[model samples]
Target: MTLTERLNQDMKTAMKEKDKLTLSVLRMVRSALKNKEIELKRPLDEEEALGVVSKELKQRKDSLHEFEQAGREDLAQKTRDEIAVLKQYLPEQLTEEELRQIVRETVAETGASSKADMGKVMKAIMPKVKGRADGKRVNRMVQEELQ
Candidate 1:
C-alpha cells in the first residue's frame, strides 16, 4: 500500500486498539498531509508523503531535545512517542558508513575541494540521501572529509 493508505489503515487500527498516542500521531500526520494537499492544490505521491513524514519527525526530534533540556520530561516523552509512531512510515535509515560513502561520492562529484563548496556537495547529496540520513550528521561528515 501507499504510505498514505497505510497511514489511514494504521489510524483505524490505532482507534480500534485504543492507542491514544498512536492515534494522535497518526492524526497529526493526516493533518500535515491534508494541509500540504490544500497548499499545493494536489495530492501527494508516496515520496511526497514520505517527505512530509520526515519533516514532521524532524520537528518532533527538535522539540524533544528542547523539552528535555528544559526539564520537561513528560512533554519530551510524548514527543518521543510521536516520533516512534511516525518512524514506522520511513524507510530504514542509512548507517554511518553508508552515509559517509554517499558524502564522499557527492563531494567528488561536485568537485568540492574546500568548505566553500559545501553547498554544492549538499545539493548534490540531499536527493540521494533524503529521508535516509540526518542532515546534521551528513554535514559533519562532509566537513570532516573536506578538512
Candidate 2:
C-alpha cells in the first residue's frame, strides 16, 4: 500500500484505540498531503508523498529545537513524540559512511575540485540521497571533500 493509504488505515486504528497523539499526527499528515495535492492539482506519487512527510518531519525538528532553546521541556517532549511518529514514514536515514561515499562519487563524477563546484556536486547528489540523507549534511561533506 502507499504511505498515504497505510496512514489512513493506521489512523482508523488509532481512532478505535483512542491513541490521541498518533491520531492527531496522522490527521495533520493527511491534511498536508491533501493540501499538496490541491496545490499541484493532482494526486501525489509515492516520491511526492514522501516529500510531504519529510517536510513535516523537518518542521517538527525545528519546533523541538526552538522549544528546548526556550526551556519549554513540555512542548519539546511533545515535538519529539511528533517527530518519532513522523519518522516511521521516512526512508531509513543514510549512515555517515554511506553519505560520504555517495558524496565522494558525486564529486568525482562532477569533477568538483573546490567550493566553486558545490552546486554541480549537490545537483548530482540530491536525487540519489533525497529523503534518505539530510541536504545540509550532504553539503557539509561535499565542502569538506572539496577543501
Question: Clashes per prediction?
Answer: 0, 0
Under the 3 Å rule for N, CA and C atoms, how many clashes does model 2 have?
A: 0
> Of the candidates shown, which would achieve the greatest lDDT relative to the real structure?
2
Error of 1 at 125 (Å): 0.4
TM-score of each: 0.98, 0.97
lDDT of 1 by residue, 20-108 (tens): 99999999999999999999999998888889999999999999999999999999988988999888899999999899999998898
What stretches of model 2 exceed 4 Å from their correct place?
Answer: none
User: Alpha-carbon error at 73 in model 2, in Å?
Assistant: 0.4
Residue 112 of model 1 has an lDDT of 91
